[model samples]
Target chain A: MTRVVARVIVTPKPVVNDPQGITVKQGLATLGFREVEDVRVGKYIEVSMEAESMHEARERVDAMCRQLLANHIIEDFHFEVDQVLHRDTHR
Target chain B: MTRVVARVIVTPKPVVNDPQGITVKQGLATLGFREVEDVRVGKYIEVSMEAESMHEARERVDAMCRQLLANHIIEDFHFEVDQVLHRDTHR
Candidate 1:
């Protein structure tokens, strides 16, 4: 099996309301970053697993996103799957 | 002024413990994603701002990361700065 690492980025859909973004924007302004016009916050997840091939790895990661990693109603998700050498439980 | 968007990704240091990731890994396992070996969670932040140049934008965002976006003691961060067009308060 090929060791694969998938990096997933989950972002709120454009139509969703994100008060966290607003709070961060205000915080930046208070920190003297007045040039900042907007801010959006999202989640980044990295998963390492063993798969048969790159294609299978990507497919499995996509399924993981749909099933649990992302909330489809309010979030849009994407990921990059790559082959990694060795198997280390701690990263 | 140039309209710039800086995408910041903050990940926990390799040495730091990530219980959230562990919980997610267990959750995935319970969901029959038994091939998964490990998981890690982080933050994805998008910041849109005005700057004189790409270099300036990157520098400013780096400062923002150092100041508020990330905790250097336990996290590591990197960002990509790009030129964007127009201005929409929501997106």
Candidate 2:
């Protein structure tokens, strides 16, 4: 079996409000980083698994995101099939 | 002034425990994605603002990461200075 690693990123839809991002921006301002104009927070998921081929891996990951990883109503989701390599260890 | 947009990604150090990731993996398994071997969760931040120049933008962003965006003790952070463009609106 090939080791397939992928990344799924979830972010709030532009039309939706992000309290966390606003809070973080406020925090940055308190820390004296007033130059920062805007900030939006998101989730980055790294997945490692076995797959028959890259095609299958991409298909499965897309399904996983739709079924479980992201909330389609309020959030936007995207992913990349990064690698089908051996013994990768970068965290 | 140049408007520089940057992205900072912060993930737990490999040695650190990620309870959220573990929970998400369990959730995925419950949803029938048993082949997923491991999952690590991280933060993705999109920042938009003005900067004097590209070089200064990168430097300031690096400092911002070290200062407030990431907890360096338990998290590993990296970023890319994506664009120094004008009137960008993609979130």
Candidate 3:
């Protein structure tokens, strides 16, 4: 089995009200970050899994994102999966 | 001034205890996702800014990440800045 690492990014849909983002924007303004604008906050998830192939890893991670990592009603998710080389094997 | 978008990723230090991640892992297991392991949760932030140059944007975004976007005491942050071209200019 190949060890795979998946990085998933989940963001609120454009129309969704992002109070957290707004709060952060206000905080930035208070901190004198005048150039900053349109700040949005989201979630980043990293998961490791064992799979038979890259294709399998990708499919599994995608399913995981859709089913558990993100809320389909208000969020969108994107992910990338990469194989990990075991240290013992690399030596 | 040039419009630039900055994408910042902030992740917890390896030594930090990630209760959120652990809870997610347990939830996945309950859902029969046995292959999932080593899950970590973090923050992803998108910031748009107006700057004189790419170099200036990068520097400003870096400072924002250091001062406001991330908690440096327990998290590490990385960011990328890219220029945004006006739609009218492209036409």
Computed on alpha carbons, the lDDT of every model, listed in order, comes to 0.92, 0.87, 0.86
- Candidate 1 residue runs with Cα over 4 Å from true position: A86-91, B86-91
lDDT of 2 by residue, A1-91 (tens): 6788888889999989999999988988898778888899999999998888888999999999999889999889888886655586674
Instruction: Give lDDT tens digits, candidate 1, residues A38-59.
Output: 8999999999899999999998
Instruction: Provide the lowest-lDDT 10-residue window in model 3 chain A.
Output: A82-91
Regions more than 4 Å wrong, model 2:
none
lDDT of each residue in B1-91, candidate 1, tens digit only: 9998999999999889999899999999999999999899999999989999999998899999999999999999988997887666444
TM-score of chain B of each: 0.92, 0.93, 0.90
Query: What does DockQ give for each predicted structure?
Result: 0.89, 0.87, 0.82
True contacts kept of each: 0.91, 0.88, 0.84
DockQ-better candidate, 1 vs 2: 1
TM-score (C-alpha, index-matched) for candidate 3: 0.93
Better-scoring candidate (lDDT), 2 or 3: 2
Ranking by DockQ: 1, 2, 3
Q: Per-model i-RMS in Å?
A: 0.5, 0.8, 0.8
RMSD of each: 2.1, 1.3, 3.1
lDDT of 1: 0.92
